[model samples]
Target: MNYAHLKEELIEYSKTIGIDKLGITTADPFLSLKDRLIAQQENNFASGFEHSNIDERVDPRLSVQQARTIISIAVAYPSKLKNPPKSLPGKRRGFFSRSSWGVDYHDVLNERLKKLEAFLEARCGPEAMMRMVDTGALSDRAVAERAGVGWSAKNTFIITEEFGSYVFLGNLITTIPFPVDKPLEDLCGSCTKCIDACPTGAIVEPGVLNAQVCLSYQTQTKGFMADEFRSKIGNHLYGWDTCQLVCPYNKKIPQPAHKEMEPDPEKVKPLLLPLLSLSNKEFKREFGHMAGSWRGKKPIQRNAIIALAHYKDQTALPKLVELMHDDPRPVIRGTAAWAIGKIGDSKKEENELLIAKKREEDQEVLEEIDKGLTLLGFAVEK
Candidate 1:
């Protein structure tokens, strides 16, 4: 029953609701995507955060019974911060990626998706459609590509002509049969900027990502990050944007239209030192609304310690030493141990690490203490 007319009406409605782009496609299983997921798993490239059920991830029907069509929507977020806070010298700040700049896109996209779902439910009746954002079993990127929203680019982001890669994606699967749109042509020919610029070489090839090494993934992990990645992370406390920053398509991005997606400069880029002593409650009050806080304060705090070390901020050594000696969480203590050693080279700082090393009981913390001692040209007992 005239699903094409409904699609058109939904498209116009989406424009009014801050949806930057919308496209439609069939709900058939993503066969190639399943193969790619298997290969990614086999290669040990997946980050282990995705839904484990690969079948549900590739087949829309498994998620929405009688699924006949998929409508993908994109919401553009701010590319540039207005009057951003400085990450300078003693007042060094940690960065939250642009995607986390505003309110959590998951919430923003969910709001849009719910609205779209309501629009469809009215026309198609109740229980005929289902909505999902990033957490859903299906790959939003795959749906976007098949729906002509954008080209899946080398950095593994859907790069739309209108929003570049600075957009959020959400989709609806439905029983209604809508006219499908053709996929966009590949515009990223021989452009290896994202791959060449990846700090950990996480982009093994065009359109492929080794999530294990992606700084974005590394920052989200609630453990002592690998020593190799610690230095490469720079000031990133949440996610990394190096790949997108280097992509040519990302230049001159459209201004973010949704006010909810606009960032507060102070919040997104915050002073690093205070983050060290933040209680869970304080952290929640400050960052709970943002996307990056899902893993809670530990990962962010761990990354902040790494960022302080990345800057060699002597000012943070006190807090780092405090954590190394007193913080109950082993990951925090261990990461702080490493950062203290990595940042402080003086006799006083070396003595503090020596004291922490002697008293530290955790094997992981002891190892990090040893590394810190090694960094300061001190010998440790075997």
Candidate 2:
């Protein structure tokens, strides 16, 4: 098999199929990444979302037997939402981060990887490749950085000269022994902007992020948001862009050319009040296709309540009162109770919290109601 000609053919074919960038590298173990990941896990800096097996994550050969080459691909996604609505006092809105704006990128990147797999299989026969997207055991950013697709920025995202860090990455381990490409030189020279701008100091150092306090990971949690993070979340309902927004490489980034990656403005940044009232079926119908909807509507709803509180949306008081008293989910109920405290000033809001405080059985929700009463200047029962 002529691997050089095949590599050229693969790169050419990638452009026709909406792949923004492609690179080839050897399937050798990622020794440096393995050490970093081990330290990251040990120090509790790792986000629990990643595949747990460190061995499978660093070595492509473990995933695809006889893997001699790795094919890394990136699809750029839009960073800006067209015609975004203003999140004002009366009519507040919450925004899904740029990453969750379009169709779930996992689906988008996987679709592209499957096509690449078929193309390689047509040449190398069956079992020549194993494809993976974000959920794959191998780190997409690590693979992309090593494959010359981009430089691994201090924000820990793969930043290509063409697309910045706003790219979805995926890769395939192949048996073809394709000629390798060298990794790019680090371009983040003395840039502490991302680390400095982190609200929770999630970027404890340059490239290492403590995901536990990261606003992006904080928004995706199922339980009540931590006190420090809730106030810092602002109007963000899913993920965050503070790191990328401050990165020098992202300032002049182009809008995505792929239609599937373009965000529907209204859908990505919906009204905050309505989000709390969305029934399960309604939430699914409206946001099911969005990547932000992966944790179901619970996190979004909770974040929406916090957004309303952030804006001090008095108009949301009635709905928040209802959720505080009637919502079955304790996270939703507790968050709403707290939001009412945060936004409310009048006797009507005070009465609502006092009534909830009397009957609320859940200790968490009761504590939130007490907080509401305290915010309203009413002393709580001992």
Candidate 3:
């Protein structure tokens, strides 16, 4: 196929395959943000991958072996129903960040990209080689910006002119030379909503996100949920979206392009009693496919206990007590202790206080223990 003709066909094919926006970049332009990349690594915020190795990820000249043009695609996830479920009453339902509500995008994007690759191979045959890159050294947002589809916002997200920042990005690195578009200029002038709205201060500064402090990172992280940060978690059981919710760009984006992203009514505002006693196997069977399940059941279980505790719903006391002593994971047990104190009666509270004292470690749990004691009409000066 001729160069211009091939490019046009490919773009049309991408749209047909369900991509909302498609554009081409001559090379990754986000390469210039080296200092920001290094800062992320130094600060332990690089998503466990180096951003400095853009050349390694999709080096059109090397990795793709004669890569001439990079194609970038954006998947919009705008939610028409705005606002997370109010941790309060009479408010709109808030669910997981729209990006994470359904089947993992990693799976979705890769599947589509693979289909596109097969189509291209059939057309170009021995004349072309194509590679699909996601979540690697390649700067997806940078490539998207270079393609004139969007600009990098202060939140380090590519904000599309039409869709705002509620877009998931994927890119194709190929040897096919195609016309390239100019990069979009930064559009996040004087907007500090994402930075100011972060609960755990993860934003740190404009255009910088210290992932260690990011709530989304914490919720899905394995092992312990850091105690100092627990209170900021609020009622978020799986993921946090405080910053994204506050972003002006996310305003009025259509809700869940795919109906699958909508929360299962059974799962939404789940009753605390059941989650408090969920077995690991059962937990896995239920949430395994959802984005919230990425960190496994421990985090979700822990969050559930905390929310119950914070809710101070006394009806959950027996379940919380059972979880405090019976749950195998210490994080769950510890949060249970705190929760027991919050919702348990004098007798149940006293029992949990004793258990908390014997814990002998995990200061956060211990604090919960002490609070339980104090609430139960007992005094222990430590």
Question: Candidate 3: where are CA atoms >4 Å away?
Answer: 28-30, 47-63, 81-95, 126-134, 259-262, 345-347, 359-378
Candidate 1 off by > 4 Å: none
Task: Tell me the deviation in Å of residue 277 in model 2.
Answer: 1.7
Per-candidate total of colliding backbone pairs = 0, 0, 7
Worst window of 10 by summed lDDT in candidate 3: 86-95
lDDT of 3 by residue, 1-382 (tens): 5878877888889877767788888853344655667666777875553344644643445556667778788877645443433444312122345556666666677777777788777888754555444555576776787788898777778888777787778877777767887787787888898887877778888878888878777766665566666667766676666776788987776554554455554454455456656677887776666656766667777777666656677767776777666666667767777667666667757866696578647676677667667666677687
Best-fitting candidate, measured by lDDT? 1
* Regions of model 2 farther than 4 Å from truth: none
Question: Model 1, range 232-277, lDDT digits (tens) per residue?
Answer: 8899998999999999999987797688988988889999999888
| Order of candidate numbers by TM-score, starting with the best | 1, 2, 3
lDDT of each: 0.90, 0.89, 0.68
RMSD of every candidate to native, in Å, equals 1.1, 1.2, 3.6
Candidate 3 at residue 42, lDDT?
Answer: 78
Candidate that beats the other on lDDT, 2 or 3, i.e. the better one:
2
Q: Model 2, 1-382: lDDT tens per residue?
A: 8989989999999999999999988999999999999999999988799999999999898888899989999999988776787776688888999899778988988888899989988887886688898888899999999999999888788899999998889998888889999999999999889988888898888788898888999999999887788889999999999999998899987887888878888888898878877889999999988889999999998999999888988899989998888888999899898899899989999998888888889998888888778877888877
What alpha-carbon RMSD in Å does predicted model 3 have with respect to the real structure? 3.6
